[model samples]
Target chain A: MVSLELKRVVVTGLGAITPLGNNVSQYWQNLLQGCSGVGPITLFDASQHNCQIAAEVKGFDPSDYLERKEAKRMDRFAQFAVCASLQAIADAGLEINEFNAERIGAIIGTGIGGLKVLEDQQEVYLTRGSDRVSPFFIPMMIGNMAAGLTAIHTGARGPNSCTVTACAAGANAVGEAFRLIRHGYAEAMICGGTEATITPLCVAGFAAARALSTRNHEPTRASRPFASDRDGFVMGEGAGILVLEELEHAQRRQAHVYAEIVGYGMTCDAYHMTTPIPGGKGATRAMELALKDAGLFPNQVSYINAHGTSTLANDVAETLAVKQALGIHAEKVAISATKSMTGHLLGGSGGIEAIATAMAVATDRIPPTINLEDPDPACDLDYVPQLCRRQQVDVALSNSFGFGGHNVTLAFKKLKG
Target chain B: MNKQEVLEKVKTIVAEQLGVAPERVTPEANFANDLGADSLDTVELVMAMEEAFKVEIPDDEAEKIVMVQQAVDYISQVAN
Candidate 1:
């Protein structure tokens, strides 16, 4: 018979390769400073595309983390996942020796995996014959390769899996990993999300959907979340990985706990394909469920890393969702739209936002929502705009909603000990 | 291509594909054993050799190329 008692989970390590910066320290520093990572698309010539601005991960050299042979075998997304996972594992100092190798696991998520590979290989297949196509094409383009490659690089032999729930994938991965540790499935999990879909096809596809900002001249100010003039989200790329350990396991290993992950809530609109349900009811329910799961009152939430995608729909809907979930305290809460600085990282957003929330909980500082010079009347919540806010953040929530109306909220609390 | 010319080109490909130094990719070096070319790596290496030499290496003939020298010999014999 399984024990009814649930184990406490804590975030022992964090790693990120984000648009604002590569590592967690750099990213967090830049975020607090309200640095804008958006620029003219350099990965590809955007002269012909309708949407030209993107928040591409700058100055990331795969050789810094992986050998040439191994890096060459994986796609850019998988490379980011492996590098972030390695960084988090090192930060945790949780050695995967012969005794504990089988007790750890991995779960990495992605929105669209390796579009560059698919586009490149498709060209090869069309111009040359099928035989000329690369043998690594399939493995490199698939979404699950991130989890698979992370596991292979980290030697995590327990339960290995991947979540492909669009933007909510990263949150789902983290939540499921938390579940594994909360129950008796695994002692630790290297879990999060990675995305590198700033390719021509992705840009064109998003442009066709009118889901991207077309502010080519002013790239830095393009992703103006909760702003009245906000057009749409600017495409961004990166990865975030966290090492979640059981409370007892972390105590035994003497791992430094950043914060405690107390709750996760997932919901689907079942209403639309891309647009969120009216008033973001699904998101409201998700936030409510997360608070309920954590056994915390709405007034207890101090900071919220809002899924502020800068699109009119997301900003307005997310604002309403917060109001509905938290009622009067929603106005008092310090909400942040870090997407203004990092841009929307798609699947990677949830992972990095969770890190941001945990950082707020641990450090008592909230990063600002840059470029929010004019707030939309509909989104009149305290959106810690213009500058970072130094406040007492005891409990924080990170929200991530995906293309499939997938809503996920993760609750994090400051470790009192 | 001459046998010596093919050997140089093959050595360069092997070195690049296997992520090893040129000195490590000797003519007698086995792709898998010495150069650490896994099964998939060996396939890609053969594809690269086939493209460079302008020759189609049949699957059966490709399987026999266990060493670097074998690739050079096959390309040298097949290339116009």
Candidate 2:
């Protein structure tokens, strides 16, 4: 008598539209080259503002991805989401027309959805009166449209939902997708996050709260994660999507398996709305939990994709959490903060970073964390600084923490076949 | 714009705004029923039509102007 094991889940596809690059390959190349996508804000006039730069998605023409009329109906955030999802679907070599539509699902997360649309409509309301607003306001401005539109576009009739956990939303969405496929709830899931909140109102709000970097004079050097001279995180806008499939299903289809998603851990700080816990207790526990769930020791993980938002408090707290979780092995892990190059993508950060981790394990190349000239005493980890390094990373982990103290950690391992 | 011109303009605006065929934006077609417009879309459509026709549509009148014909008549009265 043979007992069946629970089906494993692996990353079959990856897609991203980021400030660093519009596609995953370009993004990965930019990360290896240590290119800083952070620059002067060009989407709107930031001359009169204190926070004048952002990691804006440069030269994105939605017409390349969406239909003429469909483009008009969706906000930029949703457009990014759908476009990234399209790329992922194509990358996986999965044909929606050929598959059972009822078994496919979509789970997209967004931190601040459709802010551009909302703000624009608000201006029309104030100047031209409320009656002058567009008819697509609600659909274009809502956070859930990213997931909803993906389902509509792909004919996915299975479970469809979204997470709104700020920066952690992307990780949560992917982690939840893993469960959906592992537990026999679904055969495949298209999960990730999208965010295009780099509008004037979003910048102004973050600036008012003193949460964004004020180094407008040096936009490229502004996002210095884990550096002692770090001021604040730079805002960014983009989306990423990953196709997660059951292991057997992927093997049967002869799909390219990037990495196996082994475990996920989530926690809440319950301490502050905008600040992490003093000693990084929540993040530490999250890492520990994820390691335990994967049944692996800290020494097994050779790479880490740190959240490292370039904020003073977050960088220190994240480093502290790594030390607490990995102990003596913390120094051996090759850590890199992709946010150092892409800026803080908010909810979309975790999804894209997860892809980076999987790619690291798949390609045996660890990307670098740029702009770490003056390392902070508080962050003493071996952050693969300034230059990309080639390493045989068998296992990797990625962490994302959000406002309201939400924390998420994901673990990935190279396929052992 | 005359009544006929106003109707034609309203139909074109509604067709473009709602993403439907211009011929489908008839006087009797309901915004939600035939045009596939959700509630938020109706508001935006009114705004676009008002901008295109150079007229201000009152909320009270806007609420009653769901059909293309109703929008044309309302714009005709206000624009002139």
Candidate 3:
């Protein structure tokens, strides 16, 4: 076994443009209140689609975060990423001057980048001519533009890249950022995931795959994770970004530390593309690895932000994974599926969920899994049902499982001193 | 369109495409040096101008039209 010497990394700032709320404070407040962001799809005409409801970032005007021309040139995902990055930079109060500019980096993840832009450009190409397609189409539609634009916006001339691991992309990005800082690759990193795929093709494709909830009549209660009646995930669109800095660097700058990221573990099932292995072997190993990396036992984990996507297979498999990984301690951990309220933000889910986990570690409050009216027997874990729970939490784990059998678990611990 | 009409149209297109106020879009303003436009933004501005004027500016000529007045002159010469 290779002994690794890593620097300490801490999260100093959090930003979220989520369905629950626009910023971190509002998102956290709404999560504690168990608010649901799902509603009838107003982005486009979803009347014919089976899953018509979604958790869209309502009332988001790109002009609010960017100039009219800049907003026009970018896809919604990149817009959210830039907006969230700005918010996080401001919250961290770290001035990027000539001295430290090159030491800062950015890494953003997206499952599907600029799908809406692609769809619209394709339509323009078909109806008009190829030349009629906006010259901004290619840049706006590429997934890496979020990180590229974010670096340009923040003036961070350091490492810049994007991760595209389906739903696990966000967590993977954050985990990679943590490693970068911990390994002395950079002093600080802006990392997260952004996704805005609520387009005609995305909706139609998910509907065809039967991966979305069809509870069109009651939109608010659509994403019922770990519940017997849960049908499927409700699509959500947003971005979540965090400013991760080396502990000494953050301390030198006198930044406010939200929580210390202790460990990160990533594994692939290699079993299926869209489904987990029956026993969640890959997920269990990821959780075990994260705990080992953190130097903590299973009983030390007080809360879990589960990747309970409301799919029948995932919920049960995740429960089994947790049980296998934590044994009897699984019963004591307060696990909640925030997707029950925010719906599934796809790649954005891990970033936002990690924020939620950090906040839980900082504030000792666990958000509820709203709409879990009847628990599924196979998923027989304490899912911190419909009401928020207030309990002192020292260690928290956030899990994200993506398509292509990617599993990531991030462990965050409360600041000791 | 006449010179004055073309200038006005060019100003409007540049103002809208660059997210700058009409007053800021002076005839002497260089798109890259003055208006904070990157290469991609310049390309987009050219595309928007092409769509507005209904004239296809060749890539070689588009590269030459850097300033607002330059775009106006190119559009006026080609559009007719």
Candidate 4:
């Protein structure tokens, strides 16, 4: 094996257009307060669908962030990506001039890219003839358009790409960006995920698959991760982006470092497409690899951001994985599933949850998993349910598992002088 | 349609498509240089004008109609 010396990477900025809030501060506050963001499906007419509620990002006007003409041409997903990225770039206080433009990069991921746009355009073509379809349909519907548009908006001419690994896409994007900077590919990267898939077709598809919660009467209490009565995940839509820079580069600029990314672990189960391995063997291995990559023991970890989708299968599997990966220390770690509040952001979940994890490490406060009442016996770990906790977290791990058996774990630690 | 009527409609289309004030869209305003329209915006504007006027504008002809006055003149001629 070739020995590789990696550079330290730190998160300097965070931006989010989440179901919880439109910005990072608002999202963090709502997560800590145990507020649920799920509500009635108002984006479109969901009367015919079995699942009628979702965690939709409300009051997001693309014109507020982009030119009206520009906003009209891009899909909602791309709009969210550009808006969040611009916020992150501004938060970092790093100017991208001609000198440093080539050193900056962007990697934004999405699970289902522009599903609303595609569905709408297809309907237009079928009903109004092919010529009636808008010229911007292709650009609006492609998944990579988010990354492409973000580069156009920010003038980052360096490496640009998109990761499309279903739910794991966001974490994979951040992890890949960390590798890019760690291995000396780029000095700084604007990386995360964006998804606006709360459309008619998406809701219908998930509902048909029985993958969504049908608790329309009580939307706020629909997402109950780690609870015995949990049924399924509630679909959510939003974007989360972070500006990651090399430690030395951030130090030189006196950037406010939120947390240091010490490790990234990615693996594939190759067992099933939609369902995770029976006992989360792949997930357990990913966490172990992340711990090893950080050169830290499992006992060193203080908190965990779980991939708890409020689904019975996912919660039990994730619980088993944590126990197997951390051994006895799993019970000691304070784990929280912000998805309980934000709902399942799908591709965008990992990105926002990673930001939450970093903030927990930096602020020494862990957000709670809302609606986790009467926790299942299988999920016996400290889930930090119903209330936030104040603890000095030395290291925190965020986990993301996608539909295609893709498992990713990202490790963040409090910056030590 | 008369020249004045065509000019009024063209101005309205330009103002609506570009998200600009109606008063700002003068006959002399250029779609790109003055109205802040990129290449894609120009195409969309042409498409909108075609739909509004019920006229088929060829690509070469569309390229020639840059100014608001030029669009008004072209539409007036074709409409008559």
Candidate 5:
């Protein structure tokens, strides 16, 4: 067998602390049940703001997971990444002494890393003095701290980097991790995304840009992806991570395999910074190239975890992209936007959604796109609305489109015997 | 430390820290259940109490001091 065939990448573990739930089991359960995590903004006062709803991780306690000093040193985003990575590492059943340090890597992504730190430090500078700003400001604010801290804790000496392509970051990190194993760059990699940008500044910025929903009266129902009345995305926070291992390495170690990473495609919209191209041209190419990378035809794709952000534009553009890439098979494919339930976690969306896709492949269950009532005619597809469906999902595609026209798609498949 | 004085100070601090009304800070109120303090808030509150009174609170000790009275007594004993 060729090295590509011999050294396939597989997902050995999954972890997430999402708006919908605090862990993988809870998140997956809520996802299948179509439960909405969106609600009135609790992190800050939204009384004076246009957008008053967001999806916040309900019971997060960073100090519970990290030391007090460490927790103080890191901002919310880094804390989320560390927490999710801890779960992933434990789930993988990896022994610290089992593998060479150089053969293991860590890659975590953040769309807007440490926005909370930015806000806090700016406040300190304004209210107090520049000298009063915490000495850990820069370290806490940098996007790479998540991966760097993970590496420091676990002694993962291989390639470590943070992807910051806005929303596509999660998919980009996972895809890059898969390639690390494929190219023999690393035997195993811990990869995913974390984001905690549901702050006053972030919400105000999105609202100022007219990118967030103002459905304050009905917070739970505010995030209605693919619906005709959809207005804009609901800001969310949390982290999701996966343990990727080389097929041979996992087999030799008798590790559990959840699913296989079969394909990854990334492209640029080249159209706009904040808006996707007029018909999802970049998104279509991303999915097409992803299918090609998976060596699967359109018919082989059973489900799609759409990046349906509950915004008017993303839903239409993503629906058309699927149609363009998958042809007639797009109609047959069951499309579900887990974001409809979990809201958009920015960079963390792709990691958890990838886990959702792999779980759908592993468990033969497809999560539903909640709040799909009154769907727009433009986004007409089998959105797996209302309830979970038990269907044999051999392969699933997860799409993530970010700002700056970055588009990414990843393919996962059931592990073959 | 006068118990009433300690209780009043504790109530004020808990109310301010947890974002609740001072009258809501009763001896029977649970930090998480009645006072609306999440795990993080509780931890920070304990730290603040320690700094205010110049005392150390172990995690086990902090967990035991859930109510306003308990926290005030614990602080008074350690501080005195």
Candidate 6:
């Protein structure tokens, strides 16, 4: 029997290509300054569409990180994954050569991978002919191609998989990678989420479902989590990646540890396809499970990076969930929804938010929930409204809920001497 | 179409599919060795040729047309 001794996992590196900025530092700074990244939709001609706003990652050229031939073969989501993974690998400074390549792995999750290519190919098949479709269409549009392409680019050949758990995909990916290292399957893992689905079909579908915010004129203040006049979530595109190294591996290499990952808990509501459970029952249990997994008390959780997607239903329900999970201590926890600035990256949101949570644990300065000028009466907790605060945070939790009733909570603790 | 026209069109297709420059797509250049095209690119290149010239270069024929000149010649012959 293989001994499954749990090893401590630490976040050694972080990378992000978000709507706020292309790198982690810039994204962090913008989040701290309460800057909104939402803007007019320019990826396509959205004039005919109802929702004409999104949080698109601006000025990201694939040539900066990928070779021309390599870039041409990948879908936009895969490109984002590869770029962010490479960035994370570089930031970790842990070399991946012939010797150490077999010990490292990657898991990149995406909500909808290659939707743009699928839509484009369908058009080509209709307008042109079926045989005229490019041979790369199938491979380009698959969700797992992100992890597949990342491995080919970086030469990390351990275990790899892609999680498609909608909004919880990123957090799920990090959790799975943590398990892989904890169980001694691999030494380290590159994990996170990437999503580039601000295309016409995705936008049209979300708009039809009434899941997207229609505040075109006021795109900046549209995503108001825990606010009274809040609307639906604004579609955002980008990727966030983190390097999870075993404690011994990270310490031996003298890695700059951001924070120690203590616990990961996930549960499914099993109730709806597009809506979360009423009163946040599943989400509440997810938080409790994470606390139990980490062997920590509710009072120890000083901050929470709420999944708060700024939707009417999600805000109220998540508020109820947090209150239920933390009991009386929920009122004291400083919770902030970074989605107010980054505008919900869907699957990619968890990755960037995890980075945010780890940063909060490492630095003790939490990013604010911007655009929360009017807090909802039901949400009476301190949202760290509109301003970054300096506080001594010992433990942090990142909560992510997906469309498929998936709820994930990741606990990060400030590494002490 | 004549061989020169076929060559020019093939050069454009190769440049677009293989992500290479038109100037580098000489008649003697091999698709895999010179242009760094794997099996997937070759398949797509053949599909593009079929679409552009309205000629079905079968799988067996595609395997033989590994060089730029072979593709241009094959298309010129098939089209003409």
**Candidate that would win on DockQ:** 1
Cα miss at A330, model 3 (Å)? Answer: 1.0
Worst 10 residues of 6 chain A by lDDT: A1-10
Give per-residue CA lDDT, model 4, range A1-417, as digits (tens).
Answer: 111668899999999999999999999999999999999999998898899999999899887789887788789888989999999999999889899899899999999898988999899889978666777888899999999999999999988999999999999999999989998888899999889999988988888878899999999999999998898999999999999999999999999999999999999999987889999999999999999989999999999999999887889999999999999999899999999999898889888999999999989999999897799998899999999999999999999999999999999998888
Q: Write the per-residue lDDT of candidate 1 for residues A1-417, one digit (tens) a residue.
A: 123688899999999999988899999999999999999999999899999999999999889999999999988889888998999999999889778878899988898888899999999999998998888999898999998888788888988988998989999999999888888789999999889999999999999999999999999999999999999999999999999998999999789999999999999999999999988999999999999989999999999999999998999999999999999999899999999999888888888888998889889999999998889999999999999999999899999999999999999998766
Q: Write the per-residue lDDT of candidate 3 for residues A1-417, one digit (tens) a residue.
A: 111568899999998999998999999999999999999999999998888999999777777778788788889999999999999999999788888889899999999899999999899999998877887888999999999999988899888899999999999999999888888888999999999999999999988888999999999999999999999999999999999999999999789999999999999999988989999999999999999988999999999999999998999999999999999999989999999999998989988998999999989999999998899989888999999999999999999999999999999999887
Give the range of the ten consecutive residues with the poorest summed lDDT in model 1 chain B.
B71-80
Q: After superposing candidate 5 on the true structure, give the runs of residues whose Cα lies further than 4 Å from its correct spot.
A: A1-6, B1-80
Give lDDT: candidate 1, residue A34: 93
Candidate 4 lDDT for residue A90: 92
* Candidate 2 residue pairs in backbone clash: A132-B47, A133-B44, A134-B44, A135-B41, A135-B44
In angstroms, how far off is A193's CA in candidate 4? 0.8
lDDT of 3 at A26: 93
Docking class of 3: medium
Q: What TM-score would every model get versus the actual structure?
A: 0.99, 0.91, 0.96, 0.96, 0.83, 0.97
lDDT of 5 at A312: 81
- Sorted by TM-score (best first), the order is 1, 6, 4, 3, 2, 5
CA lDDT for candidate 4:
0.92
Which has the greatest TM-score?
1
Query: Which 10 residues in a row give candidate 1 chain A its minimum summed lDDT?
Result: A1-10
The C-alpha lDDT values of all candidates are: 0.92, 0.88, 0.92, 0.92, 0.87, 0.92
Instruction: Give the TM-score comparing model 4 with the true structure, all chains together.
Output: 0.96
* Residue A7 CA displacement from its true place in model 6, Å: 0.4
lDDT of 6 at A106: 95
Residue range B1-61, candidate 2, lDDT tens digits: 7988888887888888777889898889999888888777787787778678878787788
DockQ of each: 0.87, 0.48, 0.71, 0.55, 0.04, 0.76
For candidate 1, what is the TM-score?
0.99
